[model samples]
Target: MAVMTSQALWDFGRGSGVVALVLLTLSMVLGIATRSGRPAPWLPRFAVAETHRNTSLLATVFLVLHVGLLLFDPYAQLRIFDLVFPFVGNYRPFWQGLGTVALDLMIALVVTSLLRTRIGLRTWRGIHWAAYGLWPIALVHALGTGTDSFSAWFLVLAIVCVAAVLGALGWRLSARFTERRAVAPTMEVRV
Candidate 1:
């Protein structure tokens, strides 16, 4: 097998990062939808939950590839330390640091999820809330450090991801409010 070129690694790294973001967005939207405890138009509730879990796992895999490729690519100038400690890298430290923070959160989420049976639902849920913060940090890191951030296609992809997450969040909130109102006791006054 021919050795991989630096350019190949760079390109692969970028592609993996983009794929991870898309998967992350999908996971986020499905997670929000799952909370409603309702089946999607076509998929059952269990299927939606399974899809959410699978997408999240796939995103994590792509993220690992993205970071691994960048670490090997001399152009990225990323060290293992940079991957763990936030904002210490020589290249675009702040932006890279954001990625580190997101990674840490992802680790926490995955660990907690894996141990959910041992840790119990309340603890797992509290840690899982980090997912809400992870997507945007990863997005900002991509925009700040990504080579294609200004390119038309990347911009469009970013916009669509943002819109999808925001739409899901809005829907979740509205559904919660509607549910609460429906269940609230009404005061009956006869004067």
Candidate 2:
């Protein structure tokens, strides 16, 4: 019987982290699609919102696994404080700090979402917008801290993630513009 090595756990942690990132991106794109209020041929607006919520929850699960594995991995030597404090770790402090910051942002987003009814829509919305910041921070954390950041496959993944969000954002803007145009004629001078 072979025992699991620290390297194996580290690899698993990294893989989970990458998976979480992809899920996060997908969640964001779905969220943007929901805001567009225009459903695709396959998915309705409500389904998009449902997927967004589910994907985010799934991402959170993977993120927990990623962090848990790293904490237990001897090679990582990551302390609990390192996970939240940022820049205090023995290894790759700056890059690790970015990950910590990204995690912090995610925590806030999740907490606020779970309590949105109690928090009030306006307050929840204000905090929820922080998710936009989370994406880039997570991207940079992956690039700076990831072992495969520069690899072709990883680069492709990153490009796809960025493109997905950008495309969704563009679609949303266009939809909003179309809505405004549709309402414009109704507001025209009437005899």
Candidate 3:
């Protein structure tokens, strides 16, 4: 019987991490688009919101798998403590810590979202804001800790993710501005 090395597990962890990140990016993009009430040719706003929710749940699963694989991989040297606490990992502490922070944020968002009704809208929304902060932390963690961080494919993926988020943000801001402008004229003195 041939024995599999931890390297294989490490690779699986990395691949899943990438998938999780991509799914997260897609979820965020769809969420922002849904909020803007912009309907794509193929999908309605409700569909986009549904897709966003589904993608986020999927990302959560993959992220859990990613963390599990890494924690079990001997080469990763990741302790259980490292999963929740930031800046405590023995290897590449800063990068691993960033991942931990992202994980924490993800957990908060998921928990609050799931219990949104019980928690109340204001509280849920407050915690859910952490989801927005998770993206950059996860991105930095991936870039700093992954072996393929400097690879062309990873660079390309990073660019695409960044662009997607920035585009969504721009759209959201522009929509708010347009709404304000429309209301501004209405609010002006009417004789």
Candidate 4:
């Protein structure tokens, strides 16, 4: 096996981090779509949910790669402690701290998801709400600490992810509101 260089590690780490972000963004959008209870133009509702689950798991895998590669990369100088604790890194502490927080949330989400059957839907769902917090935290971490953050391509990617998420959220909220309104009882007021 060829020995990996510092630059290779950094490049791999950066690449994995970007892939993870894209996957997470896709997962977030699919999750919102799943919650909306609407079938996609092609996929059934269950397929959308399944896709969301798979995307999230894939994102987690890439995230682990990102962290692991960075940990070994001499340039990053990431300690194991930095992985768990927030705002205590040698490089861009605050941004890396947000990453730590996001990692913690992801851990919770993964564990809860794995135990969802045993934990019951209500409890699992409560912990799963942390996902809502996870995406933005991860996004900020990427923008703040990403090596290519200032590049035009990266900025456009970031903008696209933001737009996709916001669009999904808007659709979910509107659907929910419409659903609620449809079921609401009519009140008769006599003056």
Q: Per-prediction RMSD in angstroms?
A: 6.0, 4.9, 5.4, 6.2
lDDT of every predicted structure (CA atoms): 0.93, 0.87, 0.88, 0.92
Model 4, 1-191: lDDT tens digits are 23468889999999999999999999999988787666789998779899999999999999999999999998889999998899999999999999999999999999999999999999999999999999999999999999999999999999999999999888777744332112467799999
Candidate 1 deviant stretches above 4 angstroms: 1-4, 175-191
Q: Ten residues in a row with the worst lDDT in model 2? A: 175-184
Regions more than 4 Å wrong, model 2:
1-3, 175-191
Ranking by TM-score: 1, 4, 3, 2
Tell me the TM-score of model 2: 0.88
| lDDT of model 2 at position 116 | 93
Query: Which candidate's TM-score is highest?
Result: 1
Worst 10 residues of 1 by lDDT: 175-184
Task: Choose 1 or 3, whichever is better by TM-score.
Answer: 1
TM-score of 4: 0.90
- How well is each residue in 1-191 modelled by candidate 1, as lDDT tens digits? 22468889989999999999999999999998887777789998789899999999999999999999999988889999998999999889999999999999999999999999999999999999999999999999999999999999999999999999999988887745332112467899999
State the lDDT of candidate 3 residue by residue for 1-191, as single tens digits: 11276777889999999999999999888877776666567997668778989999999999999999998888889999998789999889999999999999999889889999999999987787777889889999999999999999999999999999999889788745332111234455779
Off by over 4 Å in 3: 1-3, 175-191
Instruction: Write down the TM-score of every candidate.
Output: 0.90, 0.88, 0.89, 0.90
